[model samples]
Target: MSERVVNPTGRGFLLLDSHPAGCFATVARMRAEAGGDAAGPGKGPVALVVGSSAGYGLAATIVGLARHGIRGVGIGFERPAGRRTATAGWYRTIATASMVAEAGGDFTFVNGDAFAEATKAEVLDLIAERFGGVDHLVYSVAAPRRTDPATGVTHQSVIKPLGAAHRTRSMEFDADGTAALREVIAEPASEAEAEATVRVMGGDDWALWIGALAERGLVNDGFRTVALSYIGSALTAAIYRDGSIGAAKAHLEATAAGLTDRLAPWSGQAFTSVNGVAVTQASTAIPGLALYVGLLRAVLGDRMQSPVEQSVQLWEQLTGARPLDLDEQGRIRLDRWELDPAVQAAVTERWEAVTSATIGEHADVEWFRTQFRSLYGFDVPDVDYTEPVETDLPWPT
Candidate 1:
C-alpha cells in the first residue's frame, strides 16, 4: 500500500489508496441534512449541474439527486488518474457517480472542459437523449482560464487585489506536519488582467448554456437556474469582495438580472445565491480567505455549516419549504448564517488581535487542516489508508 503526503503549500496532490469512506461520509452528511432516508428512484425533476464534482457544486448535485430525487447530469473538467497520483476531483466524480447509482437515481457525468461550446453541445445532447428536458440548472464552475470559441483568445482569472498589493496571513503545513503561518502578498491586477478575470469567471458562459438549452427546447416551463457568488466581510474586502474576483461576481449578478429577463418568455427564473464561506478548492486559492475561515471556525465551531448543509438549505428555500428572502439587489441571502451579527462580531474582534504569534490561540488551524485534507479523501477516520486500493475507477461514458 502506498501512503499519501499532503503538500505543505496546501495546493498539490496527496498520494492515497482508496477514498470509499470519504465518499460515504459525504453521502451520509447529505442524507442527514435532508432529514434521512434519501433513497428513492428518480421521480422528481431533471437537473443539469456544471462543475459538479467538488465543493458546493458537488453538494448541490448530491442534494438534487438524493433529497430531491432529481435525474442528475453533471459536467466537470477532471484529468484521468495517472501512475503516481490521481486528481482529487477525479476521485470525487467517481464517488458521486457510485453513490447516485446506489440511491437508484439516474446520474450521467460528462468529464470535459465545461467552458467550451463543444462541451455545452454535448451536455445538451445527453439531456435530450436521457431526460428530454431539464427543470433546474446549477452553475458552479471555478476555473482559472477560459478560451473564447469565437476568436480563439484565452483569458485567465487573476487573484490579486484591484489597487495596491495586499498582504495577509495564510496557513501552510511544515515538513514535520505542523501548521505554520505564512505571509502571502498578492500583487495588484493590471487592467488587462482584471478584464480577463471577468471574462473567464463572469456569467458569459452561464448565459450561453441557458441560451443553448432553451434553443434546443430542453428547458421546462417554470424552470429555474442559479449561480453561486460570495460576499465576505470587510476584513478581506480588498482582496476578495472588491477585487478582480469581486468584479467578476458583480458581472455574474448582472448576468443573472439579464437572464431573468431573457428567460421570461419561458416562465423561467434566474437567481444569484450568495453562499457562505466554506473550505473548497477554489476558496483555498484566494490570498487571505483561509485565515478568515480558520478564525470563523474557531468562533462559530459547531454552529458553522458545511457546503452540503448549505446546499440543502438552498434546495429547501428554492423548493418553497422556506421563504425566499432576497436583498435589495434581488440576490438570495444564503450567507446569512455566516455573516450573523454575533458571529461577525466575534470574528472581527479576533481578527484585530490575530498575528503569527496568536493565530494558533485565536483560530482553529487544526480544523482548517483537517477539512482541507478531507477534500482530497485523506485524514478520513473510516478508511484504512494503508490498504492497497485501485486508483482507476470507471466513470460514465
Candidate 2:
C-alpha cells in the first residue's frame, strides 16, 4: 500500500474517488446528529438493510444502530480493488460498522450485488446464524443497471420522460470551478427503455428479498419493511415526478400493498417512505435536481431536512416510537417539509428568477457543492487533506 494526498476528482456531479477519513467523519457526524445518545449495548430490534452503504440507506443503518440500537446487516455493491480506492458507500458502511462496534452494538456488512440470488442466499444464511429473524427491512437501492438473476438479463435505468420531451434549466461546472446554468432538453424514452428503467429501479428486487426472507421463516409478527422514494415539486416534474423514474417509483409505491398483503400472515407490513430532498450519490445524477436542490436550500434555509433527519423520523414510525404519518395511499410521507406549500412557493419564485449570473444570489450553490463533495468523502470539516493518507483503508471490524 502507498500513501498519497487524494483530492476530489471528477467533474460536474460525478466523483471518481473516495476519502476514508472524510467518510468516517461524515458517518460520525450524522450518527451524532441523528440521536446517537440512545445507542448502547442491548437486545434491540434486528434490521436487514438493502442498499445500506450510502444515501438514505446509509442513514437508516446509522440511525438503526446509533439511535435505535438495532442489530443490523447491510447489503451494498462496492469495489475496493487493486490500486483505486473503494466507493464512498464502502467507506461509509465501514465507518458505520466501526462506530456501532464501538458503541457495543451489532452491525455486519455484505458487499456485493444485492439483486443476485447468491447474494440473497448468503445474507439469509448469515441472518439465520446471527440474528435469528429480522424485525425490519429497509430497501434503498439506487443503480444505473440491474441484472436479473433468473433471466440473466441486465436492464439499465434511464432518466427521461415517458411520453413527451422536456426542457429544463440545469447546472454544470466550468473549468475554473464556477457553476453555470444551462438548458437541458431530454427526449422521451422509447417503450423498451421505459420498461427497462422500471425493471431496474422498481420493487421487484425488494419483493424478492422479502420472499426469500419469508421462505426462510425470517419474519415474525410486527415485522416492518420500508422502501425509500422521492416525489419532488412541480418544478422538476417533467424530469423527475412525471419521468420514467417516476414510473419506476410509482411501481415501487404500488408494490407496498402487495408486500404488506404477503406479510399479513405474520402480521408484518411494508410501505414506501417518501423521503425529503437531500444531497446523495443518486440525486446528483438526475437532471435539474442539483439546481432545484440549491434553490430549495436557499429558500428554505434551516427548514430543510437531511437524509439522516428524515431517516430518524422513519425509524420512529417504523419502531412505533412515533405515530405513523401516511398519505392517501397508505405510504409514509417524511417529505412534508419539502412539500410545504410555502416552501415550494418560495422555491418556485427563485427557480423562475434565477439565471447563471444571479445563481449565487438566488441559490445556495456553495451549500449544494459542499453537500455533493461530502457524498464522495471530500470537503468535510477538519479533514487534513494536506497529509498523505492511505486510500485503501481496511474495512472496520
Candidate 3:
C-alpha cells in the first residue's frame, strides 16, 4: 500500500514495509495518530530500545519519541539487508529513526547483539557519552541464534511442541486469508536447547542490560524497565510450552523477579507486559499463531486491534501511570485483557464458527487477508501500493 494508516489509538504500532516509501508512510501514520502534530514528552526521556525496528519494539520506540518527545538510542543487529520475509526489522527502524530525528528528538542506532556482554557494555558506554542515562529502558530483543561466549558454539531455537501432539489451525499467508489445514508440528527439544532458548528469550539478557546500566550509573532514579511476554489461549500451550520458546518465557517471568528485586533498592522496578498481537514478520512465521492472531484482530473491537492505539493504551495503563497491575507473582497482565473472559469467549466462538467444513461461506475472508497484507504494508487502503516503492531500506546502502 502507498499510504499506511497508522493506528491512532497508540497502544503499540502496525508496521508497513521496510521500503523508503513505507518509512515515509509510517511517519505520516504516526503523525496522524498524534493529531497531525509532532510528539513530545515535556523535557523528553533518554530512552534505550532493543529490537526497536518493528513490531512492538518499534511501536514502543515511536511512542516513546513521537508521543513523548524522548530521544532514543536503538541497539540491535540488522537482517543482512535484503530479502523481505526471513529478514530484519531494521528498515522500519531506519525510517522511523530518521523520522524521529527530523521531528527534533535524537535517534541514534547501533547495530549490535544484545545477548553479548560486550554489546551491553558498548550500549552503556554510548548512553554515558550521549544522553547521560536512560530514564526508560525497553528490552524487546527476539533472537533465534545465540552464541555461548564460553564455548564459541552457536545455538538455534525451534518452534515445535515439547512432547505431545499440538493441534492448531494457522493462516496460510501464501493463500491470502484462508485458513490452511495442517497438523500441528511437534518435536522433541533437548535440555541444552531448552536452556539456550531461555538464555536467548528469557530474562538473562534483560538483567544484563540493567546490571550494565547500574554499573555505568546510567540508570536514573525510579527508572523503569519493561519486557514483552505472552500467554496465548490454552490452544497454544503445547507449541508455546513444551516448545523451545515458552520455557524461555517461564524463565523470563522469573527473571523479572530477580531484576526487580535487585533494582528495588535503587527505586527501579521491572515489569513485563503481555501485549496485543498485530501482524509482524516474527509473528507471521509462527505456525497457527498467524491465523489465530488475525482472527483475533478481526473479532476484537476497533480500538484494541489498532497497534498504535494499543501501545498508547499500554503506556497509559501500565507504564508511568499508576503502579502496573502485577500479579501476586509480580507479572503484569497486558495481553490478559485480550484473553479476558469475554474476549476469549468471543474468539473461541468465532474460531469455531469460522473453522467448519464450509467455513469460507460464513467467514470474512477479506478482513483476514487485510490483516495479513497489512503486516507487510500491502493492501492498506490509504496507501497506493502501485508504481514501485521509492522508499529506501538500506539494503544496498
Candidate No. with top lDDT: 2
Candidate 3 worst ten-residue window by lDDT: 5-14
- lDDT values, one for every candidate: 0.81, 0.89, 0.64
* Deviation from native of the Cα of residue 157 in model 3, angstroms: 1.6
Residue 124 of candidate 3: its Cα lDDT?
Answer: 78
Q: Write the per-residue lDDT of candidate 2 for residues 1-397, one digit (tens) a residue.
A: 7578878888788878888889889998998888756546756888999998899998888888877888868998888834667888878878888887778887789988999998999999999998889899999999899998889999999999879899998977786678899899999999999999899999999999999999999996889999999998999888888999999999999999999999999999999999988988898888899999999999888878988889989999999989999999998999999999999999999999999999999999889888989998899999998887777766554
Pick by lDDT: 1 or 2, better one: 2
For model 1, residues 1-397, the per-residue Cα lDDT tens digits are 3334323233322334325445446555555565535547767788899989888898898777767787858998976655544566777777778777777778789998999988988889989998999888999999999998777999999988998998887766666656667888889999999999999999998999999998999988888899999998887898988899999999999999889898888798899989999988799888778888989999999988878778887777776668887999999888888888888999989888887778888889888888877776766667666665665555655
lDDT (10s digit) by residue, model 3, range 175-219: 222445444555566677677777677887688778878877888
The best candidate by TM-score is 2
> Which prediction has more favorable lDDT, 2 or 3?
2
Supply candidate 3's per-residue lDDT for 277: 62
Runs in model 2 deviating more than 4 A are: none
RMSD of each: 2.6, 1.1, 5.4
Candidate 1 least-lDDT 10 residues: 6-15
> How many clashing pairs does model 2 include?
0
